[model samples]
Target: MEGTPDEFGAYRLLAGSVVPRPIAWVSTRSPDGVDNLAPYSFFNVVAYDPPVVMFAPVGVGDDLKDSPRNAIETEEFVVNVVTRDLAEAMNETSATLPHGESEFDHAGLDRAESVAVDPPRVAAAKVAFECELYETLEVGTSTMVLGEVVYAHVADETTTDGKLDVEKLDAVGRLSGSLYATTRERFALERPD
Candidate 1:
């Protein structure tokens, strides 16, 4: 906390210290009609009122990754929640494929039509958010994309009386490096009034 940490060191410290982070399984469509899918650990909800979410895409070297580039070009994307069951398939999609190659096909995942966005969503995803590009910011070596949800899809079994049930969601989270966490263990605490 005293001196400035180097780039790689700072990234390692931040990522390692952040504990478990939710993964945004972002899906986007390229201008040439290719579907791109990838998982981003640097993602979270930004605003509840507007249903806004953000995901940061850190490019390799000087090349912008396909997901963010597609979102920027099309101004649309879908955020599919990564559950425990979809963990392996989600990781499969992270492999770097040549431009215009469909990760869905590579991962053997079926695609579902999106209502408000051009990009498709993961058919097996229990929950998905169709979003329109709201803003984008260049932060250091990553590009932060902010999107407003235009439509949402949720599995009926994951809901309790029309509301999402956390236990049923079975979401997975990213830890440091190749480690991951699940929602199997949970504790609720009462907030101060």
Candidate 2:
């Protein structure tokens, strides 16, 4: 725990320690028009007002992962929220497919046209954010892609009083290797002014 661990070791440590991270079920399209869908646990909202988010997709060996690759090339992506209902389909898309293969097809999920970006949204997803690429930072072996959310679609049931209701949203979270968590259990706290 003192010195730097290998990439795999560090990844294991980080994933285990992060504790219930929000998943970004990202969708992008290859230059040849092949649709791609993959889930990233290394994802979170970076800022509000302007509405920014980031996801770090690590390279497989030396090659950039398809999510970051397509986002970088196309300058567009869609972040779809994962729910218990869509867990299996989201996991299915994580398989390593050939560059031109479409995960949306592999996962048997329907694609809806995004309002702002070229990449399609998962029609089964309760929430989807269409984003334009803001920047990408080359980490050690991973690329951190930041996107500016330009549009969002939320299912009518997922909202309450014009705000997102976490209990109703029922979004899934990443807990380590094969583990996932739900948003059913939560608590609220008042901030000190």
Candidate with top TM-score is 1
lDDT of 1 by residue, 26-52 (tens): 999999999999999999999988999
**In model 2, which runs have C-alpha deviations exceeding 4 angstroms?**
1-8, 60-62
TM-score of each: 0.95, 0.93
RMSD of every candidate to native, in Å, equals 1.9, 2.1
Off by over 4 Å in 1: 1-3, 60-62
Number of the top-ranking candidate, with lDDT as the measure: 1
- In angstroms, give how far residue 50 of model 2 lies from its true place: 1.7
Residue 109 of model 2, lDDT score: 93
Q: Give model 2's clash tally.
A: 0
Model 2 / residue 116 / CA error / Å: 0.9
Residue-by-residue lDDT tens digits, candidate 2, 1-193: 3666564487788889888999999999988899999999999999997899999988733488888889999999999999999999999999999878899999899999998999999998999999999988888878889999999999989889988877798889999989999988899999999
